[model samples]
Target: MAAIVARENLTYKRWDFPNCAGRIVNMDEDLRAVGERIRSLMPGELSQRSLAERAGMKPDALSRALNGQRGFSSQELAHIADVIGADLHWLVTGAVDPRRVRIAARHAWDSDRGVRVNPGRAHDEELLGHVVHAYNAAFPDGPPPSAPLSDDPADMGATLGGSFVRKFGSVVESRLGVDVIRLPMLSTDYSLTIGSRAIILLATTPNWFRSNWSLAHELAHLALGHHGGDQAPGEAEELPADEFAAHLLLPEELVRQHDWQAMGEQGLARFLWETGVSTIAAKNRLAKLNIRYSTEVAVALKQSTPVAVRADAGDERGTFERRRAIILRQQESSTRAMPPILAEALQRRVEDGAVSPEDLAWVLDVSVDEIDFPEPDDSAAMAQAYRQAFENRPSHADLEAWLAANGKPAR
Candidate 1:
């Protein structure tokens, strides 16, 4: 598990492990032996000292509680039950209580589901199961991809969302005919599936690689046949989606081609950057395949920057900002560009009297005569002048930067 963790699995939860066995534990009978129950619930490898700290009990106190030498307070019992995911009442008395609840598994959307405003158990196993089935049925293994997928990860989105939508995005839209939309409303949130379309996320991560991984992650949900319509996705479907993402983003062939043991820090860094998978995803993928490699580079990558993507922007805001910048890149000789966001903010500043006419004149490179300020209450003229002020303010180099970054060579 530590090896897999070092590798970083794609989905919020590692789908390879059975949730029931790895996390949610159910007891057939109430445990008469409280100490045994705690030990049984915890992974065999975890230390007692670690469990003690988790349970908010001192080492000796935990031993006393486990040994039945001392009775635990309600608070202590709650913490203990939480750590081991035991039914507090059942752990105390060897009887089932209908009211008893295990703290760990109580939440409707715990480990994999994470957080959601409204989630329904809406994973379509049959629909998801049919995907590979459909592929197998169409081509029973003879005809592989005409050519190995050979696009750099950075160019995945082609435009707009960048890493958030890579090659799979084309399949989702062109082949599947699903709608892929990017909205600023989801700036701080991850993307979702609405019926068949994929929501290419931009706000979840500040870096491009993570956002792109999310792009692949959400695509996995759709690929796995999660028809989330208007409701949020259920926890039941999270595992497969995660597993699909890990395999899809970092294919085995790619991993094998570049030997990890051979690829030291620099090579690994290049591979990590090119692939754009999270450090955790890469580590866990390697561990899952039982492939061993140097961890020094992986650890350093983890600590340095969360931004691992070569994609244009780390998140959606970057995309929006870039697009806005791109628009103003085409300077119409006399018409310089002012960024929309900056224009709005500047307008606010002007109204606040923080920006005088001198400032506006200075920004425009013209005298006060050329700078136009509409009457205080004239909202329409004020807005028009504000926009004009920005249109006449952006430099030639600023325009070129936006164009060049977006792969559009300046004419």
Candidate 2:
């Protein structure tokens, strides 16, 4: 029988452990017996200490508990149960079948559906299962993808990192609720889908639309349950599960509803803007809907590169402006080396009060010069004027020596 112990005193309550008469046990020997059972189901080649580490228990305490020198507390026993997927009752009182608990937990989703918002609709588990099955069908003989992907480029990188925690931890913890404990970043590019977690990481270089698409796409993978495994189809083919996810989330109906067939690239762009979808995603979504566009004709529609979005304000708010102003003001008089153009940019930002000149210099790849800096009486005015004077400089090559001398990256 298994028993539930309180965290403080390690009290035990008899619970059924399959077909057996319930019995209460308090002896240290009983605790060792439970520890031995945990050791057996856990991964082979793992010692009591290693198992303890895996379950976040102290090594010495685990050793003592296994040696019948210490009692097993409820928290410790619960952690062990979680690690080995054992039933609490079985771990504590030697009552109740662990299998029954697993079955019950899996089935419980039907009532709650794992989607508290919409009960009638599909739950995350079912959606994930669908993707898994589809992927299996598509690639019956081929190896599965290493991680999930969000069609959105903007979010793909971060999403993958976030998804790693979500897939392994509880769904409740991952979605709709914030995890108070933040997981460290595993990889910047790829998503991790270990266990129940499903993550999608997007590159920051991509625009928000691309990021959003990647996130959505990766979510589809999890929703469809596209975990790579032997039970699914062979690897050579396009997994049916993945297809189901793509089509389901990026439904064909959305494209038809938007009348995408008649829109040209610009028109499509307009439509996407109206619909709040990225131009790239809109095109892909249309393609998935069996709509076609001429690649040759899809010329550059946006005025600026995606990188510009991350850049600061042109003359007013850039880091470059701030650094320059600070250097010029600090110098009481001109020195052999003029402030680098990078410094000028930093100075401009400092004058604008966006950031301290020092911070701006550091970011703009400038370092403090060893020589005495100027002390302009009207520091603010000098910064603003310098910003205007050098704001239009084509390049920052002149600042190379200053940057090198200061041990900063050349901007």
Candidate 3:
């Protein structure tokens, strides 16, 4: 007989069967144990009724199940797990799946809220899982070439130049060893740290400036160690991320070097063109530094478009047209180009038969028919060798005599 012990706390109550040795002896015990695990996952502020509503289950039924008075169906458990962002396997088996990618932070533009928000949806989690798995399979020994960036935002900003701004995503991937993938389906940018490596996913956008800012913001989250929770981050987390990005793009010392108040609109335009940041970002950075700028010029710059700013900055006509064409092409496509290292890794996995061509196509945002899979390897020789080895194996009588001589049992 197992001794059932009740453990009570301010937030929840659970039963611990000390003598059961982690075994569920009966159906009743199994239901109760599962219920306890679910209850423990719920936030202190969230009630059982609220959880049921989120999971689309009847409040009474959920309450009964949670109280160990009724059983929960597999469908109901799955719904609950999805709603709470809990791993279904872990909820059922009491173990975390190592293959799944865990997001540290997610930043997305919320039109309704008119701010960047972090929803932490389950679909994003699954997509990241596929990416992280492919990355690990490709580099089983360790990550590719890497150089750690400076922790100080100002120092880092001073080091990065115009070339880095032009190829922000690629520079981050190759130099920082952070995998950067741009997918149109994602509404948010995600940052994940798996072991010593980090991965960043950006929502596809044609605006190069916005994409750069998003990348920098996700990098800031990683640098600050903001391993996010199920809930959206408030001002405490969002403010620092924004500040870090500001310093990274426009170092305060560099900003102070120029006489912004005297340069007027043309000077502001040049600053914007040089820094590769939006007007609002530049305005805020100035405000933070208490650097006075002409209100008239600031307003005019804010109203001006990116193209107008480039023209005002006196960029070459041919260069401007070429950049515009590139931006137009980017806007037309739903998915951006994959990082070169990531593409190489996925292709290697396909060749090794560790992943299917269909999987590669999905990750690359292309059709499976478009993928060119390598020809199947010839296994005839290997099969013959295996058959010969099997035929030359020891017989059962010889194995029995060996076991007897070794003082081992033969079942």
Candidate 4:
């Protein structure tokens, strides 16, 4: 069957789902369901003809898609939704109103004082206004909850990452009404700021300090109207964002007094644990103080904070272990809800015979399967499965030559 293909990089892949291991998002499965929705709306004798005419497809092609005999192409589904007066988003997710998703496809820019832009990014003044408006609406008041404004930004662990995480990821959620994910991993300089829906995703799970820093970094991109556009961002924009996040996360006065050399390794480690400041970030602050990393100091620091130990003689679990336990529990107990649009779309695919019952069952969360059926005669699927199989297929002609060389006649 024909499949709905997503534009590369535009859609998230399946692995992006809340599994901590997942890294991206995609929308192919969701579009497949749109075909079902189209078919569902087009019932009766003349329905196929009506849909075909509206979508600019031949009646036979539409019939095949509706009957699950073939898949609708991406172009066909998009056009069909338009003809049916369905929002493209509705076909994709059944969640968004058409009016809400419609926006001019112009680059965001402003020229009050004539400034070069990062292209398609916040180049258009009007688009910037909408984003700013959304941001303002979410942050009508001052900044959402954050680590308490400290007198000592340079105090090793003086800041709480949990507080900052709660601010952008939680308190901000109350305002932006979009996804704000916080992941735990060692990868650095990683984040996704989807300007379209005000979505901000942060993946910095390995070190809470760095995760918190990345959150501020991504937030800076969103708030400063840096969309990164289609091109790799030049330092012209990135430096400013980095500066914004640094100022936001590390106040000037406190950073000014951070005695990097004097604090030494143990001091730095304790400060990091307390403030959620990663060593890399600490290095930068230290660089200003002319403080460099020392192996002896590092050893002292590592010895300072073992896996899990009692901060106080009364605590049962080590601080690290406690945090670990909480994370593990959260992972095990928390289930990310499937977007209603995706759920509906996949369900439609099943109903229209485009997808198999087993496939549906595997994708679903619960034991939703009741009755099972024989596997489908997915000839299209099979052909697609083997589309490139012959790329390295053994050559029959070559095989015959080899046999002749061995004094064996070809059969």
Identify the candidate with maximal TM-score: 3
Error of 2 at 57 (Å): 30
lDDT of 3 by residue, 1-411 (tens): 434433231122233467755653334655677778898778788888888987777899787777666666667788888767666767776654433444655555688888866675666667666667666666664445334556677666545554476667767776667778787667677776544466787878766667778788888876675642334345467778888888888887778999876776667666776676777777778889988878756675666446535545345885677567556534633356666776777788887877678767866778988988876556977888899999999999999999999999997
What C-alpha lDDT values do all the predictions have?
0.47, 0.42, 0.68, 0.47
lDDT of 4: 0.47
List where candidate 1 sits over 4 angstroms from the true fold: 1-176, 185-205, 228-232, 305-411
> Model 3 misses residue 198 by how many Å?
1.1
When summed lDDT is taken over every stretch of 10 residues in candidate 1, the lowest stretch is 98-107
Candidate order, lDDT descending: 3, 1, 4, 2
| TM-score to true structure, per model | 0.34, 0.29, 0.60, 0.36
Error of 4 at 213 (Å): 2.9
Query: Evaluated with lDDT, which candidate comes out highest?
Result: 3
Q: Candidate 2: which stretches are off by over 4 Å?
A: 1-203, 227-245, 274-284, 292-411
lDDT tens readout by residue for model 1, 205-227: 23445545555665555544453
Whole-model lDDT, model 3: 0.68
What is the Cα-based TM-score of model 4?
0.36
Q: After best superposition, candidate 4 residue 255: deviation in angstroms?
A: 2.9
Give one clash count per candidate, in the order shown: 17, 101, 0, 18
